[model samples]
Target: MAAAFDIGLIVLLVGIGAWMIVVRDVVVATIIFVVFGLLMAIAWVRLSAVDVALTEAAIGSGITGTLLLGAAARLKGADAGGTRLSFPITVVAAVLCAMISASLAAVALLLTYPAPTLAPMAMQNLDQTGLGNPVAAVLFAYRALDTLLEKVVLLLALVGVWSLAPDRAWRGVPSLDTTVPPSDILAFFAQILPPFGIVFAIYMTWTGASNPGGAFQGGTVLAVMWLLVMMAGVMRAPSISNVWLRWLLVAGPALFLIVGFTGVFIADGFLAYPPAYAKALIVAVEAALAVSIAATLGLLAAGPPERMQQK
Candidate 1:
């Protein structure tokens, strides 16, 4: 029964994804893509990877979906159907992909390894790091250099976006169409939301050391808060071209890399901290990442950087 359910869900997800890819209406496609992410999360849960499922739900279904929908809205009625591939070409591509997938699956099933794994090695060292969760230990303690490099990649992406951004004079600011008075109920809600969101984001980041929460989750919450502030006319998204804003955007990843390199001088290896300070280092990195991610995602949603004054 479980196998059957998993297969059914997989088929459903594949159908939805294909539909989204081929749909002419961008908005509808974005909505379908969100649904596809949710189904992917469920599939991950069924596969017993709760952590991955949480990430898929948060980053995939939540933030990525929101980004896609916002972009679709902005590009509505734009030239959307310029490229076309014949049915024969698509069929050939599908056959090639299926063959590759089957070969990969076969290789995976045939692989053999020693028992009582390196996981135990990681588990034994867990106490030294002060992180209760082994995954967090590996991410922040054992393989922190990798995490730091990943942050660099994110920073590079932000830089690439800035480089591609239009000149300040040609850039347009996003406009909100609502007209709510200061004393209105909606205005009251808007005015009260930012602080609550900030509090929630901080709580999530602090709790991440021992819990399921992490920098990405906390950063996303903060991004939502920033978005709310912009929507409510309390704050405006900063221009991407601003030097100060660019520095702020890169600071998290830059700090992470610096700390990783500094670790080599302070401890046994690059990104390896003294056992006593691992937890603190992880928290600090996460905090910085939260701020940087919030800024990056908010700006991505805001489109091109432009000179604009908040009303």
Candidate 2:
């Protein structure tokens, strides 16, 4: 029965994916893509990879879906018509791709075997690293340099977005004609929500050493809080052209790199924290990253940043 269910899901996924690609309405296609992502998440869970499933549900379906919908709205009424390939050609291409994928999967299933595992080695080093989760230990202690570089890439993307922001002098502060002033009821909710979100974000970051929560999860929660505040008009998106805002955008990655380099000078390896201070350092870095990511994502969603004056 389980095998039959898996095959049914794969068939459904392929059908929906094809429909999504051929759909003429961009908005409908985007919604179908989001549904495809959610279905893929369910498949991951069925395969017993709950962590990957959670990530796919959250980042893949949730965040990406929201972004795509927003982009579709922005592009509405714009020139959407384009060239198309013949249906027969598309069918042939898809068939060839599916055949290749099936062959690869068959080979993998037949040749795969139980291999020597690294769980024991990771467990042995866990005590020295002070991380209860082996994944956390590997991410922060054993392979921290790669994580640091990934953070740097996020920082670079933020900078690139800022650079491409519309000229502030010519555009000036954006008129908030569409932005409604917050009512007392909305303000009340905003006040009550942010503190709770902050507490949750801290909890996630601290508990990440032992459990599923981590910097990415905590950062997303922090972003939610910021989004709430912006929606309530308690805070406005800062102008990207501002020097201080730019600094805040890069602060997390800059601090992370400096700390990692310091480890190289002190411990003779990149990102190697002193044994006594590793936990504290990791916590600090995660906290900073959460703040930076929250700010960057909020600004990105707000479109180009603009100068705001006290009302």
The most accurate candidate by TM-score is 1
Please write out the lDDT profile of model 1 over residues 44-83, one tens digit for every residue: 8897766567678877887788878867876776766556
Best by lDDT: 1
The CA root-mean-square deviation of candidate 1, after full C-alpha superposition on the true structure, stands at 3.4
State the weakest 10-residue window (summed lDDT) of model 2: 169-178
lDDT of 2 by residue, 69-125 (tens): 766876886766756879999899989999998999898788747745787888898
Provide the global lDDT of candidate 2 against the true structure. Answer: 0.73
Q: What would the TM-scores of all predictions be?
A: 0.82, 0.79
State each model's CA lDDT, in order. 0.75, 0.73
Model 1 stretches astray by more than 4 angstroms: 1-11, 46-48, 74-77, 86-92, 107-118, 170-189, 241-244, 306-311
Instruction: Quote the positional error of residue 238 for candidate 2 in Å.
Output: 1.3
Worst 10-residue stretch by lDDT in candidate 1?
169-178
